[model samples]
Structures are given as structure tokens and as C-alpha cells.
Target: MTKLLITLLSFCFIQCQGQTKKNETDEEKKTRQEAIIKEHVYDCADKIHYTTQMYEYQKCLDEGIKKDSTIAYLWQQKAMPYYKARKYSVGKPFLDKAVQYDEKRWLSYRAFMKCIFSKDYKGVIEDFETCIKKYGNSYEMDHTYSFYIGLSYLQLNEFEKAAKIFKQDIEEQSQRLGEGHFLDLFYYGISKYEQQKWEEAIVQFDKSLQQYPEFSDAEFYKAICLMRMGKKEEASLLLVKAKKDVEKGYTINEDNAIYETYPYKVRW
Candidate 1:
């Protein structure tokens, strides 16, 4: 009948099954419980997606959380809408709950949100540093933990520190993936640009543009670097190209960019 009752019955059924299998390993029992929790948590997915009201979406998540308060997915789902709406304070408690229940899964994500959405650079560094200690250079939202840590330093105007971290990140990615991510190159460029290392910044920007030829932000910053070097004519031509590309929607295209402006993304 009701979703909560369904979840309870499903959970009970799994428990009973576990009882019959006295030889069930602890890992196997944990896996079964997690599978049941995931099914129960995802049962509200359709309502969460289609509901026109925030309260209705939250109601679905709240019901799941009530059925099993340990389900971190329920807490994350409850928090996300508020964060998307820029209601960070309202969403934070629920997000904190998610981290509390499943730090391994949610901690780095929380750090990314802090860096991008809340602009909490200090908190971003702390969380990402903690994640790195535990997970060893793990990725979140498609970038390494060190990438956000570098972005945090950039935001804090610790330009040299940012540049150092980005360099390490780029070298590691290059070693493992055979190339650095385009955005990582772009931000590494930004770090050098902040330090007035015009030629060095342009080199990183050129690398980024080589990967993503129409990357408007890379072009924009490269143009600025040229201007700083007194190459005004070349800078002017690049700026024109950057403007046209931006008008054609070829800017920083990260998924979260749809929700929030990325650091150093040029408006024009």
C-alpha cells in the first residue's frame, strides 16, 4: 500500500531471509541491507522529479528518511533542491546529515558544493583535504580532490599555493590519463594569471584550448595575458573571437555551471 509500509515490509523480509541464512557473512548482510535501502529510497524518485512544489519533493524524501533514518540518499535528496534554489542555509543541515551517515560517499560532494555554491573556500579546503587523506586523491564532480583544494586557494587569493596545487594535479592526471583535463588546465592558467606570470598562464591556457578549441573562457584569459605582455593587437583579435564564441554558448560547460557561475568565468 503506502511507501513507508512497503519499505518496512521489504526490510523485514530481508531480515527474515538473513535469519534463515545463518552462514551469511557480515559483508553479505551489509550488502543486502544496502540494496534494500537503495530500492526503498529510490521508490520516491518519480515524485521527486515531477513534483512542481519543493515541499512535495521533500515530502517524498522525508517519508523515506522516516522509514530508515540511516539512508543517506534520502538526506541528500532532501537537501539538493534548496541548494539549487540558492537557499544554502536551509539545505545545509540536511546535507550535513547525509555526510554524517555516509562520509565516504558524500564528503567530497559537500566540499564541491562549498567551493562552487556557497563560496566557503576555507571549508572546501578542509573537507577536500580530509577526503584526500581518506581516499587518496579521489575525484568528485569529475575533478580530483586537489582540484577543488586548488580552486579554494585561488578564491582565497593564495595564488602561489593554487598554482602549486594545480601543477601537481595536472602532472598526476597527465601521468594517469595521458593528459590533463581541460578545466584543470584552465584554472591552472588562472592561478598563474593571478600571480602576473603572463607567459606561463598563456602556456596553460593554450594547452586548455588545444583540448577544447572553442573554450571561450580560456580564450578570454589568454587575450588578457597577451594584453599584459603588451601584445595588444593579438589580444584584441583573440578577444573578438572569445566574445563570438561566448555568444554562441561555448563557455565553461560544467554541469554545475548551469546552477552557479564558475570562478573566473568571463561574463562577456
Candidate 2:
């Protein structure tokens, strides 16, 4: 309605200017204004739109899909926001259609999403390999393709492979983003801790703490590592402090996150 008012007002101005010259009738002016409105509507309908807000982005994509269901890219485009918003159930059908029409573009990503939603760590390792082979180490999100593959390996108890990937990721992200980046330290530490590399895990946790002193999960894990190394008193102190972080609502991340239990199992 706001758009209509603006366009209508502009049309009225233009029509009034040439009223004497063009001698247009009321019906003729109405018809021309209607054509202008129709053109604006069509332009809006065909536009490739984007929005940062997830719900708004969903609405925009819905309108686009309604206008032309045959457009494969629109299906792919629509799936992304839903997945990012953690609405995988809503996103799944769109992903299916996206790959159905545009296999080359959507296949690897679609497979990755399915693996994640299914919590199939082994399948994540397989699909992430496919994703990297097709698209390389693309960092379209918080965790890179390598990160997901490494975490999958960890889930499968492939500690050696997990450590190798986790170490390399830690180093690379550190070089690019700098040392003590929380995720790099957390994952690397967890991989080491799983391997019973107690001292090494403590070092990673300490590094993480240097960056974020109140990091609850890191403190919790560090205390566990210390306890294993026979530092009971220090470990007890850290446990007390770590509990405070939880009291303040800091949570441990399940699976690949260092915040969870030492072995890091998948949580749905």
C-alpha cells in the first residue's frame, strides 16, 4: 500500500503535467497507472532477493518460489536460511528439490546437511570428503569442511586421524585468525584429551583461558586433565570456578565442542 501510494502520486503528477497537451481521459489515465503498477509488481516478483533476518529471508524466498517453482537455484537459495536457522526439518524438502534440479550445485552441500541432521558422524566424514573434493576447503561458515571431517573422525574414535586434522586446522586458523582462537584451542585440546595426552590437553585449555578467562567448558576440561595428572588440589579449585561459569549460564557444546564431556558424543 505504501508503494502504491508513492507510485500513484508520481503517476498523478506526470498525468497532470500533460493533461492539456496529451488530453488524456480519466479512464486512459487509470489504465496507464494500472500498467505502471503491474510493471512494478512484476519487477518485485522476479527480483533475486536477500535478507539477513532468517524469518524475513524465508518470506522473501517463499514469494520467489511461488512465482517460479521451476527455478532450481531458488530452491537451493531457500534451503540455506532454514538450515542456518536450525530448521532442518523445514529445509529438507527444499534441499531435495534443489539437488533434484541442480545436482552439480547442491549435491555435496545437501549430503552434508543430511549427515549433520541425522547425526551420522561417519557419514559426515564421507560427505565432507566429497564436499572438499568438489568445492575444496571453503569456509562458508564457523567450522570449515576440514573441521567437520576432523570432528567426524573423533566421533568414530579415529583419534590419530582426528588429531592430525584437528592440529592442522588449529595451526591454519591460528595463522589466519591468530592464536588462542577459542574453537581452535578447544577442538585441538579435546582431540588430545581423547588420546590420553593429558599434559597437551591442559596446555590447549590454558591457551583458551588466556583468551577467554571465564570459559566454563575449558576450565572444566582443564580440571579433569589436571586431576588425571595428579594435581587434585588445583583441579578442585578450577572445578569450583568452572561451576560458577555454568551458574552464569555458560553451556558445554555437545559433540565437537570442547564444552561437553571428555569423549564428546553426538547429541541428536
Highest TM-score scorer: 1
Compared with the true structure, all predictions reach lDDT values of 0.88, 0.69
| Models, CA RMSD each | 6.0, 12.6
Q: lDDT per residue, candidate 2, 61-148, as tens digits?
A: 5666654454566677677656655677777788879878766667666656654553557766776677688777665335677877
lDDT of 1 by residue, 197-257 (tens): 9999999999999999999999999999999999999999999999899999999888999
User: Model 2 TM-score?
Assistant: 0.62
> Distance from true position, residue 240, model 1, in Å?
0.9
Q: List the residue pairs that clash in candidate 2.
A: none
| Residue pairs with backbone atoms closer than 3 Å in model 1 (clashes) | none
Regions more than 4 Å wrong, model 2: 1-67, 70-93, 100-116, 252-268
